[model samples]
Target: MNAKKHSTLDHALDNYSTADFLLSDHFVNHQLEPTPETALLWETWLAGNPPNRHEWDRAVYLLESIRLGLSHYAGQVISEEAIEALLARIRETNRQYSVPVRSIGRVRWMAAAVVLVLSGLLAYWWHGRHDSESYYAERMAGLQSKYTERVNRSRAVETIVLSDSSVVRLAPGSRISFNPSWDGASRVVYLSGEADFEVTRDIRKPFLVYANEVVTRVLGTQFTVRAFDAEGKVLVNVKSGQVSVSKDDVPEKGNVQDASGLLLLPNQQAVFSRRSEEFSKSIVSEPRVIGVENEMPSFEYDAVPVTRVIGDLEKAYGISILYNREQLKNCELSASLKTETFEEKLRVICTTINADYQKLDGQVVIHGGECR
Candidate 1:
């Protein structure tokens, strides 16, 4: 023991309350007996001893060196009950803290009591710290898992980077679910509605996307999928690389033609209609950008009757239109009305036909408004 340890031991003796003595004896025996907070306090005091600072630093260095040298001892297994029983024997011997019984056997008995109490406290503190660390680790793991589990409402457009650094752009009113551990036999994702995927190449594990009863399997492909339950259609358009689309029940080997299956190249589209049980492939010259671009024609005014134009207006603007029986036949006009509101377009049409227009509950009416 050096000067710092000697001074520390002297201080320990001066502060020899039962708790201090018990703690000091345990430390001297190389046993842990302090709570984490208490252990921190002991370390703090050791560092603050200015007179013995050099010796304290050297002692701490040696302790670390000894710990590394004793790494093999970590494999030893000991039970808490055995340690407790030993501590009980020590407590019984020193319970009264009476006079010195000067017999060889009596000395040995006292020494055994000291070792037991010291070792028991050390073991208890070590186990407590270890248990506390493990508990925090488990809690952190649970929180990480919760981060990936989510339910989204509304139209949400999001971009996500996968474990392999691939990017996917999810469309509005779409659902996408993936695991945090996005690795294994296959990198899989569940998709509902629409999304565009730009996959990184990992030939070892193919990327799979599941939508409804359809499964798209590919390796390093760029593609867009528009799957809708209400529309009863799944559109798979590949912009680059190869993709394989097969019905859930389709086997690996059969007389299934390319029409029943599709291996799409760049700028190709595969549409599967559930109602028709049909799969169609086409060389898409100009792919319709789903959700981003409107697919319907802007203006249709060639030989269409007035009734047909009004019907188109109602469906496009989500409104109702009523016209007088005689006005309906006389209201025919050749006009283009895209990018115009229900009332604005109706006003134009009413003016052209010399018919008065009225608005009612998001509806356009032309009077003399008859039953028809």
Candidate 2:
């Protein structure tokens, strides 16, 4: 590759850090077209970056594995374009025909593809043959050699305190493994199930949790992660502080602009669907008062204009409540809601005002006609 071409390819590869992007139709069609130029581009790019070679190799392994599996099924080797088209067709078939694809055991690189091919015409016979938990166990086997592993086999939640005084509450059937020494630039833990974490404040070393295909990063925060191996979704719910959630496969190369993910604040949650390779942000089911207990504001209202009432609620919970100020200008609410939950308060207020509220994109939006 020429210098200009190499530089362009390098810039593009830096952004294509996630395996999902690499496996997408755009990447397959343009970069893996079996042309000599494409081959040279990848060869030069891979040879230039020794540290990221493993990422390239892993993507290649997944692509070839999918190709070989499809070839074995069709009795002929398929081209990259053909593979992309077939995968798209399979996804559409799944949506149209409701043909469920089971997850594979060893590698979840291209989970949908691997499972669809291995199932062979959507057979239910392979349902219980391989366990997804084994895949997680095998993936963490290498780290287990150097990390401390904690499993909560009991019915109750288990409490674990890390070396940095970070607390982790592992739910039943959950497991977490981490380095005890805390010598790295970041505090990392591998999780396979559900856990609530209260990380100690450390601006220098951000805390990272690897849960299935999703990764949750925080400087210091309280959050819950539910990522069971057999489940199709990974959830990160922030209770306090901020979190950056993204696909675990995305490589961090010291460029903030190159990163693609969701930034979650208190009471915000992110859901990652393994099948769609998508992330969705929303408000948590239950939102609590945001500030310190002693400085908490009262939720009492005395025939106050509905706008002021909503403003108080927004300040108390640190959530956005949307409503037209002009329409609700004549509305008044009188209630002592200090004991009520977040949703309960909204329900009570909406009921009194003959209004209804809907959650949209992590905010509560009220819709109602102007009161007389």
Candidate 3:
């Protein structure tokens, strides 16, 4: 097959007109998948002082722009047929504008024009296939009437301090909108993308973060909310204090009370699926100590029963660890676990006592055989 392609390329170079090579499969294949043989052949041809060298350069530029435009904007592979169609469109456009296709000075302008045209078409198709407006745009539009918006367009994280002293670290490409003045009822902020929030304590006005389809309500806490518009699920991970995550459409009857939602404590996470509109609770990937550093629990257990060790871990991390007392009563461990992580401590104890642990509904459950 490579030999046949090489033959075809040789024939095109020898007999075909300068611009006619643009339509040859050899040129398209070379542009798409360049091999050493094809590169050498093209270099040799260019070295022969072809009169249409400018046209060749222009063609390469145009083809590269088309490939890049389609890949970046449409996220699709460029087919040979699509390239042919695009070439035809460029010719038609050049003819429509009464410009020569091989104009050296206009090559860059033409390539840019083609890219813009392709970008516009991709945008139109994307909007037609999906929602007319992006999830972020739709949510922002809904709040435009009553809120002030801030967008983080930079590559680095942006810090936004609200009037209530709540600090929001907005991720790049994310945006948030909030009422300029709180009405003493509730402080609400709508988010699109990910953000880490350190909300100030306010018993009177609860802080709420509305992201995508889920609403996260907290009085005063530090947490991270990951709710990108294009993602299939929304995530709320509590770092300190507590938060209630619920569907945005669900009405809250009383103060900070969600009709149906998951209450996430420190080191807990809630994953809300957009398709099913359901939530699944789980422990965060890395659970940290909940309280102040000075009050950190001593994990150095010396000949202590497994139950007492588990109790200390549960209290330190503010997570429940369930195990059968009768089964693990005889299990004893003597290890200095102060340096181990929450999971490492659990693993060390469980492994010593022939037990296995699993996380279910944001809590750790242990399954172990009777210790002799």
Query: How high is each candidate's TM-score?
Result: 0.35, 0.63, 0.63
* Clash pairs, model 2 backbone: none
lDDT of each: 0.53, 0.69, 0.72
Instruction: Quote model 2's TM-score.
Output: 0.63
Predicted candidate 3 versus true structure: per-residue lDDT over 69-100, tens digit per residue: 45434435556577657656655543344333
TM-score-best of 1 and 3: 3
What order do candidates take by TM-score, descending? 3, 2, 1
> What is the number of residue pairs that collide in model 1?
1
Per-residue lDDT of candidate 1, residues 1-372 (tens digit) = 321442214543223222223323333333223354444345434423434444433333333222322231244554556545544543454443322222234554555465445445443443455432332223224443422522235577778887788888888766666665764577766666688999999988778776654668888989988764333457788876778886645322211234246677665677775534567665443332222136444544764556667766655543457876555664565777766544456666766666665443224566652212
Lowest summed lDDT window (length 10), candidate 1: 64-73
Tens-place lDDT digits, model 2, residues 1-372: 322442112333334333432333333444334564565455444434434566554454344344434443353345657766876764443333221111222232454355445434322222233554343565565454668899999999999999999999999999998889987788888888999999999999888888887788898989999987545568899998899988866423212224578999889999886656789888886688888877676778888888888988888888889988898889988889989988888888888889877665678888884677
User: What's the true lDDT of residue 224 in model 3?
Assistant: 98
Instruction: Give candidate 3 misplaced runs (Cα > 4 Å).
Output: 1-132, 144-146, 250-258
